[model samples]
Target: MAARPLDVAFKALAHPDRRRLLDLTREETSVGELVNATGLTQPAVSQHLRTLREARLITARSDGTRRLYRVDTELLDEVRRYLDGFWTDRLGRLKAVAETIDDGTTP
Candidate 1:
């Protein structure tokens, strides 16, 4: 079976360098700028950017002779939705326990 989009996004985000790239892309930037910010070689930065693009986590647009890249927040919203389930479940359980304790229902 093929990996789901969320799975692909998670895999792409597994690398610290890729995560750093995402952080740096809070504003649109060029590959060369990313390389300088990351202190990574051009090839390495390109490789990471390619993976991020494939995962739909980032987008590139041609500007004059340069390509500007930025985070694709809509796709990132999917990732956030997927991760939120775990936190939501845990928080719900904690809230229930807290309510039980407040009601003197814990034994």
Candidate 2:
């Protein structure tokens, strides 16, 4: 069985190195720059980049001899919206429960 898109994205984000890579891409960046920022080997950074690319979280473009990467925010926005909805719903429920308690009603 294959992992869902959301699952793949979350899995890609689960690694500290991958998260750091994403953070570093706020500006267009190269694998060399990523390696320098992360202290990982070029091949190791490439591996993480491959995972992020597969997850649709980052996009790469060739610039002469170097491949520059940037975060593709659409998928990230989708993930953020999903998480926001989850939290909003849960917090709304919690607020209702608190209001009930304040009213001296059993929850």
lDDT of 2 by residue, 1-107 (tens): 88888888999999999999999998999999899988999999999999999999999999999999999888878878999999999999999999988889654
lDDT of 2 at 21: 95
For model 1, the superposed segments whose C-alpha errors exceed 4 Å read 80-107
lDDT of 1 at 104: 100
Please provide TM-scores, in order, for all candidate models, with all chains considered together. 0.74, 0.74
After the best TM-score superposition of candidate 2, give how far the Cα of residue 107 lies from its true spot, in angstroms.
28
Alpha-carbon deviation at 64 in model 2, angstroms = 1.1
Query: Each candidate: RMSD to true structure?
Result: 4.1, 4.3
Per-residue alpha-carbon lDDT of candidate 1 for residues 1-107, written as tens digits (9 for 90 to 100): 89888889889999999999999998999999998999999999999999999999999999999999998888878767878998999999999999988889646
Residue-pair clashes per candidate: 0, 0
